[model samples]
Target: MHSEEDAASACAHATALIAAGRLAEAREVAETALETDGPEPTLLLVVARAHMAEDEDDHDDDAERVFRRALDLFPDHVDLLAGYAELCLRSDALDRPGRHARGPVLLERLRELAPDSPQLLRATASTSVLATAVAKGPSAALVQSLDLLQALTTAASPEAAEKDARRRAALAPYDRRLAVLDATLTALARPGRAPLRLLVRRRPEYLFLAQLTVAVLLLARHVLGPFPLWVTCAVVVLLQLPLLALRLLLRGARARGGARASGASAAGPAPAEPPLPAVRPYTRRQLVLIGAGAALAFSAFVTTTVLTHLEDIAYPRYEAAAPYTFRGMTRTDTGDELDTTAASDPSGRVAAAFTYFYTGGSGDGSELAVTASTGDFHDATAAMVYESDTLLSSTPGVGSLDDSWRADAGAYGGWMQCSRYVEYITGEHKAICFWADKGSMGSVSFKASDMSHADVEGLARTTRQTVLLPASSDS
Candidate 1:
């Protein structure tokens, strides 16, 4: 049986062997120690490392299991926790969706044990950056990443710090994380960078403040008249100054608390004293509520603005001076005009009234109908066509003689038909065409009993070109 000293030495030797890339020898030494001592922490760590070194698919799982067993024996052992946390980091175990997984639990415990430990800081920072990128956005992730890198550099030894710098520089061109790190380092190297770095590191909540400020500014712009660039810049500065002062006050309080704790610890425990009242600057729940409220308000304001703009586009006022004439229809008729602007409709529907009509000598006619308010004629024309289809479906005497087809009409396009019959008005079958151009909706219905489908389509196309195209060109 091996002595305690022999087992300790064996564990050290096995660790050295594993570090030297001697996996087989490390495994043998670790297995022999485990058989003799029945699973000490150091021996288990060595065995876990040996398992991790093996070139196999399940090596990570095997090493994690071994580390877990060691952790059960020595829960507070920093080295075992560190090793397990590192394994978790490599495996992305914290990113998995679940409640308090082994990886996150161990990392939190390690943070409590050694808050200023560089390795732990680095792991937490990396994981936080990744998590923030997924949850928030790229800008937030970049800010958090820079903060962590700063913390890492402050906590790490000179050699390790230099190594990290070099590694980041090497990876900057290929990886976005390293690129952000490099940019932040460059910014820090310049004059007057300390204050900026301090703000980023201590006041990450400023990112949310900035977003809210922008949202408010957009809401203002929509409500009031447009402001100049310099005015907007001044507004942002004015808004942020108060928040900056508050952050500074919180930071000062934290510093003073740390100093008091250090002094109390140095003087040893005092006699039983009264507990101090809790003073929290901000809680996680409060921040979440604030963010959610701000986001919802911003979304509502933006959506309302967009819908208002679309409504204005969909129901624009009709312009009377605009030309609404077409070929094979020359005689202007004004008797059938219907104006309903004076009458109130309870349904609140905007009334469409026939504005003008042109009749041909051969009993062919085209009519121009327009709503009282001007709107996007594209949508107005589409709505009118849809209404016509509904009428055809619901009206007993109205029926289509052939399938409708699309035809290009000047700068825009519309639908045309060879034959559409109204049995109640039965004298001659007619072709029906509807088109939108130059911000106006119009329709042409002509005797089509002797007209071919191609002839109907051609007539509709030519009418749109002659009437609407010339109006748009003149405008």
Candidate 2:
């Protein structure tokens, strides 16, 4: 029953507000039109436009907020649906948390409402895997995304009733984009093409550093005592290794290819005379194999370094060393060595201790684990204890280790529990020992302060000896 004039006026005002960077105002106007006229697709479309405008103006949160609101208002609307899908895609690209929070459900809704929209189908193929991963697991997400993409590729094919030329033109761009993506991937897969340029230049240095650092981290996390310095150093080094390896592999392959090609051409038939010796050009297969083997070796080295350190990453003890004294299961606030056997004589150096304990479910009914912080990492002193569980999951716990806790005196950062572990050999225990002293130069003035990894590790070793180790053990 809505007239053209009413719809036009509402849409015009909405568009003008959007143009003037008044997204919130535009949304209000569009909503007013919907209230007055009842379910006008164009008005809903205008509202989505306003959301997009808001997103462009650095108000992505507001944009998504408004998009969701408008979708709620017009659930069966396709244009609005497409707008939502595009917003989800953009959100994922921007790494905005919870962008795909509602993607799978919304995608399912779209399938039921507008099953024929190619863009929706394409998004399902591309975005669903990640969406599902965020909402579920990686394996499930990947499988779903692939299925959607396959379905989309099939659905968008030329229908039998269409004119060949028109259909080809209509489908040509989509085909070309897919082809370009495949070609780019193909080029990347040709031996040494994995964006490893940085790694290539410093391959030898990186591999050596990676191996040494990994060993140091293992020693600290498992054998010495968990020191933040060791864990942080290991992470930065690990990230750089792959980049360096890719670079080295690419460079080495190029150098070998150039040498082989030059050697072959030089020894081949000259302009006037055939060569007395038959020179052979190396097969592409051989070059590929060599490049692959080199890449594999580099990968193996990095993987070995990563895995070896992971088993015992939690070096949780970091208090001044104390004398060993066992007194019938006495527990200290700071982890002290359990030498409760007798009143042991004090030694010259303090003892360091690293302990790992898991507690959950009533003594044993059905079995459930409720992980809790051991307070070792929460110590407000200068001693920082770095801890990680079996999986190396890196779950953001009750604290910030993301280089944001460098400031605020008298407050130490808390530990994060990571469930995502790799190659965990159950029942195998690991610990590291180290200590550190907070120097004036080590003090931080802000959240983004850069502390010396080496100094921290050294201090950690010292601290471990003072606190976790028993002074009388050596005696």
Candidate 3:
């Protein structure tokens, strides 16, 4: 071994010797070749593995020393770095947390050098703790991590979680719960899954997400407008679509982001890469209980939402008192003279006008006007009359459409929006607000010289509460 090529040739021979089970001879040949030739990472790799392969009680210590020495001389060598990292992780001998600590530091270095390297997967796969691998981001690509985890879970018993985790007395980053969440649970759950459970539990992620979805759906049932049974049921199932789609999009983005973290492709013909690493997951029975509990919880949640919102399946137009007082104002009928404007709505739902003026709200001569123009609003009333905000704002009776903003009608199920602007030539400063809940929808207008937005919204809430009562007692 007189030249670099000779050293390379020698590294190959030593590797063959180690593979042939001649550990002592492999060490000797590699060390001798290093003296004859120059320093070589591959040769040192051979020597280190020979020590690692030896049937001694402390083979790790010897192999680790060789790797450390090689890395010191050739700190940037890919194979040396990968080999050393694997050794440290293998013995659970991570670097102490420090400025240049080895545990996380070694892992970071490998990530920088070959982020997408198959060798990284191989080196880190043997690590007993899945938590360490999964912290922030998995050490390998998501696809590789999934593959490694699958391998681990395959070996794990469907019932023995503690058996595989092999918990230690001291707290470490790598712990049992990480893989046990699904590994063993997947096994136990797989055998008994009916079609629905199969669909629900096919991906552990789906099972968890379904629970999350149920929670959100329950919240929506009360807040959304009345729907017939069909619409309500459709809403219950369709709600999961957006949540699942969001998660899947996020997962794919994470995979793409990690895969592109580094751009250090090799310049020449790429060297032979390591094969994908095998994984061994620990399985436990706790997840089975968790899944069962989750399934039950989800079912109960869905049933509860549908039943509680049974009131939501129908929206009978609310009955209104003929006369009422709000704040400092009192309501008076505007008489039998037809409100031609209300009758002009395209859908005819806004044809029956419940128009009134609540006067005496102020000594400054300000009055609050409310109009419940009713019609076929529950179905499709053109955006112009009962169903439209923009169209309503543009209507002749809604003051001038100068400036407008949306306001909430609180408990009356606010589709109530506020508009603070009015006509081209009128000196009157009016703020108008409107609300919609199925067939029950109306507007309130404030005709005060200096009425603030809050005043308008406040009066609108009072008006909606007074007029939008549930169906009259008799019917």
Best by TM-score: 1
Q: Tens digits of per-residue lDDT for model 2 on 16-129?
A: 555433456668888998888887767777776676654353555656665667677777777677666656654654476567566666677788887888857755754655
By summed lDDT, which 10 consecutive residues of candidate 1 come out lowest? 270-279
Query: Which ranges of candidate 3 are over 4 A from the true structure?
Result: 1-313, 322-353, 358-365, 373-389, 392-394, 397-402, 422-426, 472-474
**Model 2 scores what on Cα lDDT?**
0.41
Tens-place lDDT digits, model 1, residues 336-389: 454353234444333333444455446433432222222244344445554457
For model 1, the superposed segments whose C-alpha errors exceed 4 Å read 2-29, 48-355, 363-374, 377-391, 394-404, 414-424, 436-442, 465-475
Q: Which residue pairs collide in model 1, if any?
A: 316-373, 316-374, 316-375, 317-373, 317-374, 318-374
Candidate 2: deviation at residue 44, Å? 3.6
Candidate 1: RMSD to truth: 16.2
Among all windows of ten consecutive residues in candidate 3, which has the lowest summed lDDT?
A: 168-177
Candidate order by decreasing TM-score: 1, 3, 2
Q: Candidate 3, residues 342-365: lDDT per residue as tens digits?
A: 656665555355767778776322
Give the range of the ten consecutive residues with the poorest summed lDDT in model 2. 439-448
Query: Looking at candidate 3, what is the lDDT of residue 70?
Result: 94
Estimate the lDDT of model 1. 0.53
**Model 1 misses residue 303 by how many Å?**
21
Sort by lDDT, top down from the best: 3, 1, 2
> What local lDDT score does residue 161 receive in model 2, on the 0 to 100 scale?
14
Q: List where candidate 2 sits over 4 angstroms from the true fold.
A: 1-5, 12-28, 38-41, 56-58, 93-95, 118-475
lDDT of each: 0.53, 0.41, 0.57
